[model samples]
Target: MAQGSGGNVIAAICNLFFPGLGQLVQGRIIAALIFAIIVVGGYALWWLVIPAIIAGVFHLWSIIDAARFKASD
Candidate 1:
């Protein structure tokens, strides 16, 4: 139904704002933590442009991955 898909949409939007937030919402603690670390840690050295680009990739990947996730019943 539309309601179930709505949740996934919201999760994707959440991920758009913060890489790991959607995973956290879905109770994917480890995955969320890893994403958070990758994104945040990447920015830790803001002077390096490469890490920032990699972080951007991770951010987009998070959004797509969250949208595609289907919770098992």
Candidate 2:
């Protein structure tokens, strides 16, 4: 397994801009899609400004977690 620490770091940075961005960076299409929907839905429900922010934080966390992925040889 390749070391994806860099990708994860990048994803975390992107999460600050938008939720689900980290997942996209990590190649987690499904997770990214789900998070995207949640982000969108949050916005739909009264602009979801606060929830969006929270999601952004969580997204970053996910990215960090992905970065910790150690490849097993």
Candidate 3:
């Protein structure tokens, strides 16, 4: 999908609910896995505060990344 397409919009929305879910929808398996692992791992360690903050940053990054993804021609 091209950047700024309807698919990207959908992907961004999916990421809003769960980071990396949008990447999964976009067929970016590696990116999806990385985002999911990092974000989820940080969330799992939320008691540490810093990890939770990092996870939050990654969550937003995932959403923006999904929204801006442009498939290779």
Candidate 4:
């Protein structure tokens, strides 16, 4: 709740809304895009409950990692 937070919470929220967003915010574009593609592609191709669950778990992990990350000052 102060200045110089470096978008940690923002990254977490992004990751929560969409998996891989945290990595994107961390500047890991390739990793983020790849995961995003996997999630979307899996949904379109499989349309199974397992894929959705996995994606949700991954999203939650990304968000947690983002939230725990130490922002640059």
Best by TM-score: 3
Any runs in candidate 2 off by more than 4 Å, and if so which?
1-4, 47-73
Candidate 3 per-residue lDDT over residues 1-73, each given as its tens digit: 9999999999999999999999999999999999999999999999999999999999999999999999998
**Best-first order by lDDT:** 3, 1, 4, 2
**Winner by lDDT:** 3
Q: Compose the digit string of candidate 4's lDDT tens values, residues 1-73.
A: 2222557778778886787887788777886887687676655645687887776666566677666766355
Candidate 1 per-residue C-alpha lDDT over 1-73 given as tens digits, one digit per residue, 9 for 90 to 100: 1324887788788988888998888888898888889998887866899998898888888888788887666
Ordered from best to worst TM-score, the candidate numbers read: 3, 1, 4, 2
Worst 10 residues of 2 by lDDT: 62-71
Pairs that collide in candidate 4 are none
Residue pairs in collision within model 2: none
For residue 5, model 1's alpha carbon misses the true position, in angstroms, by 1.0
Which whole-number lDDT from 0 to 100 does residue 27 have in model 2?
77
TM-score for all models, in order of appearance: 0.85, 0.58, 0.97, 0.63
For candidate 3, the lDDT comes to 0.97
RMSD of each: 2.4, 3.6, 0.6, 3.9
